[model samples]
Target: MTATAELVVDAGRRIAQDHPESPLAIAGLTVRYGDKPVLFGVDYATPPGAMLAIIGPNGAGKSTLIKAALGIVPKVTGEVTLFGRPQAQERHRIAYVPQRAGVDWDFPATVLDVVLMGLYREMGLWRFTGARHRKTALDCLERVGMRNFADRQIGQLSGGQQQRVFLARALAQDAELYVMDEPFAGVDAATERAIITVLKELNARGKTIICVHHDLATVAEYFTHVLIVNMHKIAEGPVAEAFTEANLQAAYGGRLSGAQVTRLAGASS
Candidate 1:
């Protein structure tokens, strides 16, 4: 097998042996953006091979929680462990997919080029993309059903295609854990379905997946675990149990209309 394939297999084996009950364990995690507190004393654990959805209203710190867990954001106080190690120590085992809006789509790069960037950690900053890297990039695209568009410029693709390309890049990293932010935003139904399929496949392979989601309609269908948050963690547990009217009220602060609450509760059922 190729080095990339071997790495993936080894990670999979480690995941199987460890059977890490939690991909991320946060205790008293608090993040502040300048003087304003974002995440307040958040405590949660994301289990392996489970799809955990972080849901809340705008400025609820869902994204902040993910960033704090990844060590990308400065935390006021708290501890975050990934696979029982500091996030920096286990960086290779984790992958991240930021929202499409967070990227500069105007950059002059092809889909293949973008996906190949995932190899940078293994390839090193001074190294160049070689034949093996190219092959791996192609395989990543193929896994996402985007191999045919490898040569297409990123800016030329539609929003959904761009999202898929980003996902392909993340997959190419061969990580054990995936943290995605707003992955289903600005996509067609087909794209959403495709993303869901890939997420399910990844979970089945023993990879942990966490998504910062907005749509209240698909929580039950797409997520096994749910975390409702605003400035602090409101509720977290199995989707069927955690996504309740009371929890929504707490997260939304009585601002969510009764009809909206009913809709969310019904959909989560």
Candidate 2:
């Protein structure tokens, strides 16, 4: 791709190649804060039914990439696609679970109330929360083992419990694609296992999941695809293909040894 093309993804002018059927396709996405660029010409596509992990060292813009693609942040240039269509056109089909630390847990909302908010896409904000909607929200909460906490104040819950409630909210969305920012961060072991089990079950049901993950040791066990970045595209593909030492070295600046890489992502070489 040319320098000019790197700033935009004009289908006719830029690279002819694109992941036409991908659940999420980031075409040369870039973001900058002041003069310091947070992302540089990142191009990647999420495979259908893929549990993809976005891995990088701190400050590599992993969260920014997700935010930019989802319109949470401003992008210098680039285009995003969803299910072969423009992002805005297909955004309703996707659900996002932001980082737990970013939430305002002190708000006076109940656990069930949070999950009920997910129904706004289907039932408008003005629509009445009928028995059916309540049932759906309760069902989602039950899926994450939070049914008992339905009426509990969000601020009173533990960190892991709070995370579970958010996952239940995402489940209530009933979306085809799930984008999560560090669902496992700061959670206890039991919570981690529960979240992964729910994620795996969702993946088996053909949901495409894109998660910004920091724990390298869990990459191989949790995801089928990986995207490694460092303010730019480094490597991205199936775990075996993109999680190798050479690629991680390129992203982490050679601080990671071959043995470490192999153990981290279960890479062959």
Candidate 3:
């Protein structure tokens, strides 16, 4: 790791050295697709109750970082901890929202059915869902403004509506930590607003949100913490401190122009 690149591992450790019990802690995490390394020795820890945005250019492994931490993908090296415990033991406390495009929406399930899937872990797969369980599912949908569409087929909804339903499903888990892959990608303006509003409200209530976000313009407005990466971590900390011109240049390399960097810096400030 370069002196500059060491920021990838050290920045996260600096977040919580005295307390390794942060919401999520990753040490020396690495991923490789055969001989090609996707992530190289990334060390990161999420601040408790922070709405952190992990940002980087395409192919930066933003999604892979989260996936590896969540154990959705295999890790070539390093260890991941959630709430100071091994991930498998504490997985019940986590909620994950995968990329919208990855779901098979045509499976003849209603919006409510998808949200109820969140309860399968708690209710057991073959166990019947009682009225209370159904109520919890409805309340989750209501939180995301999808209660009216609960009976609608998942495949019939627009992209934004589908995103909202997924968000509701995550909410139904009642998890302490929510990790999402590009929650705002390709959504309409109103859906974006609704999503941000719900996320901020969750953060206010002490839920830790670690999201793989793409848009730099909304980093400051939507998140309190930022992690910039390009295979190796570039910068990470509270948004105001880490989302800077130098980090942007390092994370995106020559992809961002002087004017584009200037605009991002201005927005972040």
The list of candidate 3 runs beyond 4 A from truth reads 1-18
Give the count of colliding residue pairs in each prediction: 0, 0, 0
Off by over 4 Å in 2: 1-7, 11-17, 254-259, 265-269
Candidate 3, 1-269: lDDT as tens digits: 46544554565455435346688888778898788899987877888999999999999999999999999999976678889877899999999999999989898999999999898787965679889989999999999999999999999999999999999999999999999999999999999999999999999999999999998888889999998999998999998899889899989989999788988887877
Backbone clashes in model 3, listed as residue pairs: none
**1 versus 3: better TM-score goes to:** 3
RMSD of each: 8.9, 2.3, 3.5
Q: What is the TM-score of each candidate against the true structure?
A: 0.90, 0.93, 0.93
Q: In model 1, which runs have C-alpha deviations exceeding 4 angstroms?
A: 1-21
Judging by lDDT, tell me the better candidate of 1 and 3: 3
Per-residue error for 181 in candidate 1, Å, reads 0.5
What is the number of residue pairs that collide in model 2?
0
Give candidate 3's TM-score: 0.93
In candidate 3, how many Å is residue 165 off? 0.5
Summarize candidate 1's per-residue lDDT along 1-269 as a digit string, tens digits. Answer: 25644454444344433534577877767788998989876777777678999999999999999988888888876667788776788889888998899989989999999998888788976688899999999999998889999999899999999999999999999999999999999998888998999999999888889999999889989999998999888999999899998899888877789888988888877
